[model samples]
Target: MSLRAARDDDMAWLRRHYHQRRAAEFAPLGWPAAALDAFLDQQFALQHQHYTRYYADAQFLIVERDAAPIGRLYLLRRAPEHLLVDIGLDANQRGQGLGAALIAAAQDDAAASGRGLRLHVEHGNDAARRLYQRLGFEHEENLPTHAAMRWRAREPVATD
Candidate 1:
């Protein structure tokens, strides 16, 4: 399997993934229905717009197996860190360690770029939060229905 930046072509797949997986977190957060509808459209449109400045800023990754896309990860850069805005593996691809592999890939990417791994998981998503915790991330803040988490590289060793 390989993980690489997603192409504009992958937008269709990404939207299908999100549309099918809309979080139950929003209802608890009281997110306005119309507001969420617009937000989702704008978020997906950014990838389709090839001429936008954000084209290069946002990172969309596609996980491929034997040249076929099996999963997607969407990231947003916010100055000090890379935020994991979305991640999804095909249902058949789940429970086979692909999710962990993706995070490991992100960890290496973050280490190389000198930025910490960051994400916002719905507060009610115990499954994902537990997975993040197991991957060495720590809770940083709560956003009503969600929580921000971070994984930082350990400090350098002391010289002899």
Candidate 2:
């Protein structure tokens, strides 16, 4: 798998994958299909340009595989540090190490930039929570949905 800057060519795959992924998450929340669709439409409209802004700010990227968009890794620069806004895989790609690879890529970016990385994950998402913990992230605060976490850059070293 490889990561590339998003292009118009990647939109179709992104939309389908994103909707599928979002639907699964909202499903457990008891959201109706219409509500989920509206949320996704709004989210897409609001976020489609994020990579451009982040890239300008030097913060985000889209992860691709075989030329198809597979996931996203975004960082929000907040003065003292940056928060990882999101990192996720297409539904079909989960369990294939893409999620972990995405997080690792984010961590690699943060460490390379000499800044700490932070994120939030649901308390009940044991798999994700454990992955973050394994990568040396620790709790910083509690969010309504989960826990705010941070991983301070230890030393400048490459990890693959």
Candidate 3:
């Protein structure tokens, strides 16, 4: 697996991925499939605009395997901290070790820089929350829609 800068061609795939993940959350509501699709499209557009406006400097990356796009990772590097804006994998790519590896890499980067790594996970996303927790991230704040989490750099143990 590798990451590359997202290109214009990747927007469609990204939007589709966003819709698939979000639609599942809304599935229980029993909205008509067509109506749900339209709603998700609008929401995705709003979210894309929000992220672009607020995180213009963040690295918007496309995660690839064997030259095929499989996911995305958005990261913002800031002094004393790094923000994991978003990470998602295609349905077929889920349940693999890729997400863990990516998070581990981010943790290593944070440790090397003496910085904390942070992210927000939707309150309903138990899987992601559990993963973050297992990887040492602790909930820092509870937002109306999501929970903010952070992982602090570990202190080095002195070998006497």
Candidate 4:
């Protein structure tokens, strides 16, 4: 129910989480177990390097509940907009409104900063797309593999 800066020790969990989150996607390929592990390792390493190099200033956070890690949220604060680089909850943690609550908190933070929040969801992830849309994110662009979405803070209503 809270976010904390990722520690060096968290890297192992992060890597395992990444693999668990992605293993299902490659399952349909019928790759051998060793091949799948190798592929996932390469992909994880590349993604880690890319995020580190490009989002050095971003908040690499571990989402925890009762002092145990349950997910990760990578957010980059920028003028005009804040980038939600990535968010992933443990498979067992999905649903039950946790993801929505976490995203709502991020939205609140973005609104307080007078900025919009943006993220890219894979086209194949219909559930995530629906969740983002329900959270008020609008389609900004369609990339080859992912959809770019943005959520702007609603202006306050005026009273007479």
Candidate 5:
């Protein structure tokens, strides 16, 4: 898999991906399908504006495999800590090791820079939470809607 800078043309796909991933989350709230779509449309626009305004310098990347877009990864490279703002895969592309590989690469980058990698996962996202834990991330704090996690660079062991 490879990453390319997200372009204006990608906005539609990003919106669709966001909608698909979040639909199930809102399904439990008992909203009708049409109502859910309307709600998501407004929410997504607000979220996109917020991210662009606040994280203008963050790298907005589209994850691609074989020249086809498969996901998105937004990362903010900062001193002492690298924030993984968001990472999502197409529903069909998930559970195939792509996310893991991307995260592992981020971990390697963080270690090389002596920085910690941090992210927030939705509280109900058990699969993602498990993946983070299995990759050595520790729960840092619980937010209103999400759990903050951190993975620090491991200290080198002295060889005998």
Candidate 6:
């Protein structure tokens, strides 16, 4: 249960992870294997380009457990706030509190710096939305495809 910097060799695993993430949405379309592969490839490429261009300085990390890659966490540290660009786990790794642990770590980092943590989750992603809410992330804005959410560190209480 640790994270390491992503490397060139991780492209293949990343691609597979991307495909897995979107496969369920497209699965019902009943497209041919070739067509589905092509579509996913193109979509993955586009997403890669978008993240690369916009989050050039972001930390692209590979989440691992027992030396095996199981997830990814992309983060961008900026003034007054930090962005949780993306976080995904292998399908098999879901629902075991791993995501919560990862986000908790990010929260700690932001709190230590006195910065708020922010992220966006797709409207259709109810599970993610619930998790964020449970972690104290409040809805800040609505976008066409996603909802912006933010979490601020709780201030310390003064005692006599």
For each candidate, give its TM-score against the true structure: 0.73, 0.73, 0.94, 0.96, 0.94, 0.97
Model 1, 40: alpha-carbon shift in Å? 8.8
Better of 5 and 6 by TM-score: 6
- Better model by lDDT: candidate 1 vs candidate 5: 5
Instruction: Please write out the lDDT profile of model 4 over residues 42-147, one tens digit for every residue.
Output: 9999999999899999999999999999999999989889999999999999998999998899899999998989999999899999999999999999999999
The numbered model that scores best in TM-score is: 6
TM-score winner, 2 or 3: 3
Candidate with the greatest lDDT versus the true structure? 6
The list of candidate 3 runs beyond 4 A from truth reads none
lDDT of candidates 1 onward, in order: 0.75, 0.75, 0.91, 0.94, 0.92, 0.95
**Candidate 2 residue 61 C-alpha distance from true site, Å:** 2.1
lDDT of 3 by residue, 1-160 (tens): 9999998888898889899778888899999999999999999899989989999999999999999989999998887799999999988998898998998898888789999899999988899999999999999999999999999998988999
In model 6, the Cα lDDT at residue 86 comes to: 96
Tell me model 5's lDDT, rounded to 2 decimals: 0.92
RMSD of candidates 1 onward, in order:
5.1, 4.7, 1.3, 1.0, 1.4, 0.9
Comparing 2 and 4 on lDDT, the stronger one: 4
Clashing pairs in 3: none
Candidate that beats the other on lDDT, 5 or 6, i.e. the better one: 6
At residue 97, give the lDDT of candidate 3. 82
Q: 1-61, model 2: which lDDT tens digit per residue? A: 8766555666666667668766766777777788878888677756667655654564445
lDDT of 6 by residue, 96-131 (tens): 999999999999999999899999999999999999
Off by over 4 Å in 5: 158-160
Ranking of predictions according to lDDT: 6, 4, 5, 3, 1, 2
Error of 3 at 99 (Å): 0.6
Candidate 2 at 118: error in angstroms? Answer: 0.9
